[model samples]
Target: MGKLYVVGIGPGGLEHMTAKAKEAIEKSEVIVGYTKYIDFIEPLIKDKEIVSTGMKGEVERCEKALEIAKEKVVSIVSTGDAGIYGMAGLILEMKKDEEVEIIPGITASSSAASVLGSPLMHDNCNISLSDLMTPYELIKKRVELASEGDFVISLYNPRSHGRPHYLRECIDIIKKYRKGNTPVGVVKNALRDGQEISLFTLENFDDSIVDMFSIVIVGNSGSYIKDGKFVTPRGYSL
Candidate 1:
């Protein structure tokens, strides 16, 4: 029996790929992933058999990968951290009797935080607003709780053409706990092609430029900006 490897290849480019991730893909007899992510590492796995699925075909992709793993070494490719909005959990759930290995990668929040300053220096939680799997009310409740907890928040799938007012809706929920002037940072396509970062306050945040590929970071009460970088201090006495 061959092995199953769930690999997170990081953002869209090969530049941020880890050695382990590369090895998993390279060692695979078959590579399976969403079509766009498959395209990113297409060159590296050109010799291997490729299986591509559409955006809404996550379960199908994982099942196909698992079936392939029964007879051949298979790698299930994902963008960002496989555990974070990736294929790892779905694969695990379907692996009722099969063994699988999960290889982590750089999640979008951390990558965007690196581009912005140290906004995640303290406690934080990442919330995705896509509402594809999660309920909108539940996401709103999480956002409110994170704000009440004073957690530096990283929001994935913030805004999109499909959900034009989701960002505004989130901001409305956040303001109930955080100050209007709280620092906020937005990074689009982090560590990938055409990356853009926007630093602003919660009140003046511009959601117009955000899309499905963007990541948004909102600081806690103590967070601030310095030297043109977003900084969320850790409350050190020194």
Candidate 2:
């Protein structure tokens, strides 16, 4: 039986991709991933067999990858880090004692943080606002708790056309624990083409600027904005 590799391609850029991730894809006979993610590495895996699916076909995609792995080496790719909001978890949960390797890459939170200065230099947590697999109520509770704990927060899947007001609702919960001037950074398409980085305050943030492609970083109470950058200090003496 051939081995299966779950790899993180990282921000859709070859520069951001780890060497191991590239090696995994290069060695695999087949490449499987979301359609957009597959397009990101299209040049690299041009000669390999590609099995891609659309938005909600995650389960079907993984199942196909696992089945293909039984006879040939397969690399299942995920954008950003596969472990974080990617396919690593699902692949592991579904595989049964199969020889599987997980290759980690830069996560979106860190990619966005690099563009927005050091907003994640201190303690931080990532929360997804998408309610397809998880309940919105639970997500709200998590946002509130993270806010109360003063953890620098990275929000994934902030908003979509179907759930337009979810981000606004999360911002309201965050406002209850964080100050109006707390630094908020929005990075769209981080490390990828047409990247846009914007800094805002918790109170003045424009939800309209956010979308499924953006990663929102909400600074903790100690976070600040300076010289057009958002920063969450690590509390070291000057």
Candidate 3:
């Protein structure tokens, strides 16, 4: 009669995690997550049974957690908010009448937004460039629509060695609706070791520096950079 807790650890650091997420992990006798995400919370679960898998093993990891939760309190972790591109949905989808609790934490988009100032103050949409689970054509369409709507856009899984040009292609699609001067914020390893934040314009953005560890925010038409801070005006009279 053990329960499952799906937890979001947040931005590769303990400080970024929520109290409920921490408590869930502490209460679990078995912890599960991707290899790197597991590393982020290694100190907390050192004494607990850890189950980790590398990339593309998400289904396997979730299945393992379901099995273990039958006998032990199990906590499966995701890097960002569990519901946002995290493990919570998958676990819920695969379970049958199992008691499950979702513990949310800061998502990468919000973490990156905070580091870059306030690019997300206005209407925004998050779109992942990775086509592994989604088709590239659909992803491109979403990017185009987000740009057309003038919503601040956050791009996740922007680039990697396997798909080096995906980010560039997405930028080109965004260019169709956004001006070259629109502000863009790129954050690498946000709130984590070796964090880097850069502010630039859509036309001059250096996509070469972006990788899997990066999150890119493309501002709406009204967004701007002032005093080295990237911000989107919420239309409030000041």
TM-score of each: 0.97, 0.98, 0.98
Question: What TM value does model 1 have?
Answer: 0.97
Candidate whose lDDT is highest = 2
Q: How accurate locally, in lDDT, is each candidate?
A: 0.91, 0.94, 0.92
Distance from true location, Cα of 102 in model 3, Å = 0.7
Candidate 1 global lDDT: 0.91
* Candidate 2 clashes between residue pairs 3 or more apart in a chain or in different chains: none
Give the clashing pairs for model 3.
none
| Model 3 score (lDDT) | 0.92
Cα displacement (Å) at residue 146, model 2? 0.4
List candidate 3 segments past 4 Å from native: none
Residues 1-238 of candidate 2: C-alpha lDDT, one tens digit per residue: 8889999999999999999999999999999998999989988998999899999999998999999999999999999999998999999999986789999999999999999999999999999999998999999999999999999999999999999999999999999998899999999999999899989898889999999999999999999988888888899999
Backbone Cα, N, C clashes tallied per candidate: 0, 0, 0
**Tens-digit per-residue lDDT, 1-238, candidate 1:** 8889999999878989899999988889999998999898887998999999998999999989998898899999999999999999999889966668999999999999999989999999999999999999999999989989999999999987788998899988888888888999999989988999999898898889888889999999999999999999888898
Candidates sorted by TM-score, best first = 2, 3, 1
Best-fitting candidate, scored by TM-score = 2
Query: Candidate 1: deviation at residue 132, Å?
Result: 1.4
